[model samples]
Target: MTETLSIGERVAWYRRRRGVPQEVLAGLVGRTADWLSKVENGRIELDRLSVIKSLADALDVQLGDLLAEPSLLDWTPDTLGGTVPKLREALMDYQQMSPLLASDSTSRPPDLEILRTEVGSTWSAYQDARYARATRLTPGILAVAQHAVRAYEGEQQREAQALLAMAYQGAAMVLTKIGEADLAWMAADRGLAAAQESGNLVVTGSLFRSVAHCLLANGRPTAARDLVVASVGYLENDLADASPTYLSIYGTLFLVGAMAAARIEDRAMVNQFLAEAEQTAQRLGHDANHMWTAFGPTNVAIHRISTAMELGDVQIAVDQGPRVDTSTLPLERRVRHTLELARAYSAQNRTDEALALVLDAEELAPEQVRHHFISRHLVTVWVRQRHGKPSHLLVGVAQRLRVIG
Candidate 1:
């Protein structure tokens, strides 16, 4: 019944149902009554997931309740609302918490090779932007990874733990993409614990990226930045003979740090981090997807555009976004950067170009486009602000995104 209403309408309804005063609710989320009023009246758009989560907390409702994402026709089965519970169940399985429960005399020994291959497959699907397929694959991979970690002994056990850590890292990333930031944090924490058990510095550093991403998703950018900085410091002493794996992990940390700094509008730190990342990329000397980090000169350039966008230098992003060729990158990276460029176009009132880019991105990865908040919000604003007749292209995209019936 609530699905038909806009987010603001739902907020207003929930606020009234709870008998909460506007001022009180507003104060709870650190906003003024006037701000809340604008939100409820749909005069302001709630683009930030952090703000939406805060309102949900203040209203004593689930985040999904406030989001009220209309189920898209093509993607409903694997929607965030539909898929997160299964992943949550897998992550929360009691057997993983107590490995002894998973051990049995009749059970077959876990096949380490199969488990490793499945983990790699999961990440490959994810990098291809097949989020639903990746999401579906994660629970099984995690279950097998946990079993492998329990079944193996000595060095094999450590190897299994590293694989488990990578599986959890993949899970955390998928959760973040689906807007389950809290769950993502839990997955990252689990990954970090597994990484420590493996005693692998590279795995630990990579898992740090997952944790930082969760922090950024949860709107704790300062904490995210600090975490990345510390992680980099931990790896600082080993750079003398750093492998491509180390360079990728080290450089990607700086990229994530740049993003975190950008969120807080820390101009100096943003520049510092970006410069550090670029230097690391140059040392690597070419585009490579080492450790699935996608750390290279091209990737660094992509982050520069992203940081610029985050810092509200829309002109810089607008100027630099189009020239960068992401053709050699993973499908996920390519599509994401495309959406970022679309957002810049929309911000500059180049609606036609923005719409075209969105269309192009949707063709490349329909699931990603449907699930991304930026695309959804952009379509919503375009629909709301339009006059007598909307563009058919816009209407088609909106319908596919479930922004309108």
Candidate 2:
């Protein structure tokens, strides 16, 4: 329903739904009530995606919900240029390989232990923001895992199934970034099935999170929230005596739930989920990436900043972002947190700072930043809004990224 509206129409709709008076909303975000009124009435065009992003955050919706076009497919990597990369090709192969799917041998397969280590290495690449590298490993892992699942019995079979689930989950993550929601959903669907067979709570929760992530990218926040909410039951029985591994999984599911709530502007629900996640994080005491979940006190704080951004409190995002140290976290998390802060700065019309942060992201991870929609949006805004000569760096990035002529 909300997806059909124009950006301003969506803003007015969300703002009213949230029951924030124009004066109140404006004042909360450091803008004049008249400015907001004009924005809502179409007296002014909200040309900057960054500003619109801030407005949506203020309205407590996902940045896409207020977008002129909310479909992620509009700016998918394939749409950015003509061809999908090798990473996407690997994912395609995961679903396309024929012989691998048909092989049903019940004999001892390849080394399960060696396959498990390789799976861990792929996951490490994902954490480092080496998405292309990570995705490139997925197809091979998926093939190996399928063979292991058919041949190995007992504990080795269970381990193989777990690895297979993670491989699918990994495919889903990278596929989502490339804006292949349908493909990503397919991978997630396979992952959930494997998790059920493995009967591993942590793997089940993680796979559920992967599905939620795909749904979120596909603009089904309500469905995503419901999906994640149902998966929380996996952690309940063991949480009381949970190890750090269980705690991380426990907290991450809730955090992802909070994000889903944020997308729909359900402040109370978001807070409720975050509060539960906070308790779990507190028990864990410090930040650590267990099962690749990255759940703990610092991680929870990072999500708080993200929630604040989703809630449209740019000031809170700005304030909280710097306090969380990125050095200890994975590069993917750092890139995500930093990009949000860059959006917050752009919301305030701080173009130079936003540009600088955009550059920082590119420097931190070339793969993630290359052909990124946010970078393209930022470049377009800088071209439209900058006086005289823009920064050589900005022009260079925009030109190199083909964001501007």
Best by TM-score: 1
Clashing pairs in 1: none
Q: Give the Å shift of residue 30 in candidate 2.
A: 23
TM-score of each: 0.87, 0.78
Q: Please give, for residues 10-63, the per-residue lDDT of candidate 2 as tens digits.
A: 678889899999998888767999998887765554644446756866777765
Candidate 1 residue lDDT tens string, 114-209: 888889988887888777777777887888888777777999999999999999999988777766778888999999999999999999999999
Model 1 scores worst on lDDT over the 10 consecutive residues at: 69-78
Model 2, TM vs. native:
0.78
lDDT of 1 at 134: 77
Each prediction's total of clashing residue pairs, residues at least 3 apart in sequence or on different chains, is 0, 3
lDDT of each: 0.84, 0.74
